[model samples]
Target: MHTPEHILIINVTRIGDTLAATPAINALHEHWPQARISVVGSPHHIEILQNLPGVVRVGALTKNSALFRGWLGAKHFDLAVVYNYDQALVRYALRVARHVVAFRQKSPAINRRLYRCVDPDAYPTVHITEHALKLPVALGIRGANGRILYRCTPDEVDRAKDRLVGRNFDGKRPLIGLQIDSFPTKSYRDWPVESFLALCRRMLARWPQAGFLIYGGPAEMPRTQWLKQQLGDSACLFAGLLSLRETAAQMALTDLYIGVDTGPTHLMSSFDIPIIGLYHPRHPARSLGPKDHPLNFSLDHPHDAAPSSEPQSMSDITVDRVFCQVEKALATRGIS
Candidate 1:
């Protein structure tokens, strides 16, 4: 045990995974309240986690030279936690820390012989947040209260409202937010635009007084437009419009959110908003479901991926399957 006062976490996963890892970060902070906890991530996620409580620093891995790894290696971290156990990532941890802890994934023989490891069987069975917290749990470190907190100040909330109201979204109506894009390479996580349109159409028919807001970043604008074409003037498309902070504030007021397994779905988890989380088999319940959450509805493929099996895509998730989960989510939240 290093009695580590300064620590670093290396998580090369997406925005959702990085956010899910927060419980572990908070646990580490609780154990060493005055210690500095830093994270190395891509520039985009650095913005999300940088100013978070307990995070002392955010270092960029995407920018800087390949030799920057060598430079960071000299920082002499007291401890390092490697989330996704790639050999290159493990090697980085080994160089930076005197004590390196990693998940015990089946790896090459050389890596199997190297790192202090934890088996996955001992962790919480529900939600990625709880699963990540197991790293601290295995070491007897007390974890934070299993709540996902996004502290949006009243001013931020007011600003978000002002922005949305400017776009004619009155604060009174039930706001249902939709996320339609997954990463392009991971298109299997997406529900077809027409399917989403159908879901929205059903919601509108049921709740004519409600308003819908569609969310996505710049990369997703084209799909957002296609959804808009399907929807016509029936809904508001805020795609590529709000900053991450503003998006959080705006989503806080939402009556419900429907989307595939994406960043905003994880963000909405923090708000306690009822969510219809559409997932492919690619994102299993074991690692990425909502936690202690007020209302979470998920659609997952029954089949698990095998070495010989092809990965399942979002299109495999039928409109009817998602609509059933949506109705369940609304019922759970007592929205109707």
Candidate 2:
């Protein structure tokens, strides 16, 4: 009912969830072309939104605890879109924005004040981004596109290439990026490292010209390093090396991606590249696989009753099976 000239989006979740809000954000820009967007989020996670279409400014909330109230008292946002159900943020949106759009949280009493909100479970089968669009859709807004808003510049892509060249990567072949580990502690979302290494070997045997870029965070350096060591030659590690923007740029250069159900894997989805995400039975592929990208291929496998190891389902998922999926994805040129 009310159009917000200046909009504030408050998302303080982790990398993946933060990135998950892109499609809806893009749709918001499309629906409201004249609106200026400002976002508040975690330090590193908000980096991806740097060049996002019409985003005027990005503010970090982690480094400054008082930033929330600053956003509220200093600038009055016509509308606030809160992605997660943090009660504090909900309260802030209510105080600052004339209108608020968010997903329904547990405390209906608080959410009842918002201009619009959607039940997250209503579209359980849909991509998370699609669910996000439901918020704007609830506002009688339409034509909101469903693409991630990560914008990589030519310079950044070239920088990624330079980084690769530094690592002895030849520009002649189609690069295949691999992310072997999930979050350091949350290994349940990860497939086995050996499986990735084995998959790399098969990939090398098939496409010798294919290069590998190993991606992970500082916490995942140990596991990522081992995989890089085993992968060897055409392989390079991007763990503690690149900034978030640089990661997107490098991922844009990748021909294909094979990784577990992790944040980086989802972050890589921003680029229009083919990604193979290995999923465990505990968490079904349909549940957490690629959101809107057709190029993403998710392989779901069975697991033991009790969780013996993380990614328990990996034991049942054979390297050949994963390789077959990888080959199939490459065969498509990720056109879908």
- The digit string of per-residue lDDT tens for model 2 on 1-336 reads 556699988888888778878877777787888999999888767888888887999987652363356453553888888887677777777777788888887897987888886777543366666667777788776766665557888899888878877878856366888887777576766777887888888877777777888887788888889988887776888888878788788888878988887777778777678888887766555656776677877687755234345535565888888887887788777422
Residue pairs with backbone atoms closer than 3 Å in model 1 (clashes): 188-313, 188-314
- Candidate 2 regions exceeding 4 Å error are 62-75, 106-109, 122-125, 142-145, 302-312, 333-336
Each prediction's whole-model lDDT (CA): 0.73, 0.77
The alpha-carbon deviation from the true structure for residue 251 of candidate 2, after best TM-score superposition, in angstroms, is 0.8
Report the C-alpha displacement of residue 147, candidate 2, in angstroms: 3.6
What are the per-residue Cα lDDT tens digits for candidate 1 across 1-336?
757888888887778877888778878888878778888876676566656677778877642322347544364778888787566777667777777777886775535644467766543346678767767776678646665555677898898888777877774356788888878888877878888887788777777766778899989998898887777656788888887777888888777888877888887887777887776665764456666677777666656444126766566667777767767766756766
How much does each candidate deviate from the true structure in C-alpha RMSD? 4.2, 3.4
Q: Could you estimate the TM-score for every candidate?
A: 0.80, 0.88
Q: Compare the candidates by lDDT and give the number of the best one.
A: 2
Deviation (Å) of 154 in candidate 2 = 1.7
The residue-level lDDT of candidate 2 at 168 comes to 80
Off by over 4 Å in 1: 63-66, 69-76, 86-96, 104-115, 119-131, 142-150, 301-334
